[model samples]
Target: MLPPELPPLPALTRAEGELIDRYLEVLDLLGRINPARNSGTYTGLRAAQALVTKAAALRDALTVMHNRGESELHGETLARALRVLDGERRAGLVTVPPPADN
Candidate 1:
């Protein structure tokens, strides 16, 4: 479930919305990148995964900034993204940190 503190997306500008879409695309692309863990690993793919994660965080932060009513949106989205990435990680599609201690 989305964070209740998250304000609606109505306040986002067209460009901002586009950025969010781009971030989602990045995530999709990340899923497509082969980890190639067999032969020395694909550092490029891992790098792309990190880049996409950072992009998503930026998108969420911008969304929250545009709508302060959902001050926790960025954190919430990051958490959800991490969960989705967990599935990807388990499938050997990407490598990220272990789940948060909390």
Candidate 2:
């Protein structure tokens, strides 16, 4: 089974919404590659996979909702974290953290 869907983040502006779409596109393209934010392990693999899967789900959800009029196309808060991660990736920082082996 797939992971649970996350609560949608509403885009507050057209600019932000567009940014979110761009960000999701980037994720769908690149989120699968493990950024190796921690020591390589099973946890890192899962985290990387989760990043790609969840992002693709959320991206699809947003697109469908926008098409169905269930949600705004431009949610300001949507993809805010993604914007941050985008910045971090551009800055050569870790994007996905491995789950703690507890």
My TM-score estimates for the predictions, one after another, are: 0.31, 0.33
Q: After superposition, which runs of candidate 1 have C-alpha atoms over 4 Å from their true positions?
A: 1-7, 34-102
Candidate number with greatest TM-score: 2
Q: Per-residue error at 42 for model 1, in Å?
A: 15
Summarize candidate 2's per-residue lDDT along 1-102 as a digit string, tens digits: 997665555435554455455555545434334455444566566666667666766577567657766554433354454554454454333355547899
Model 1: per-residue Cα lDDT over 1-102, one tens digit each: 765553333444444445455555555545455444323346556656677676777677567656755443454554454444343344444454356798
Error of 1 at 97 (Å): 8.3
- Which ranges in model 2 have alpha carbons more than 4 Å from their true place? 1-36, 65-102
lDDT of 2 at 74: 32
Top candidate when judged by lDDT against the true structure: 2
lDDT of each: 0.52, 0.53
RMSD of 1: 10.1
lDDT of 2: 0.53
Candidate 2 — worst ten consecutive residues by lDDT sum? Answer: 85-94
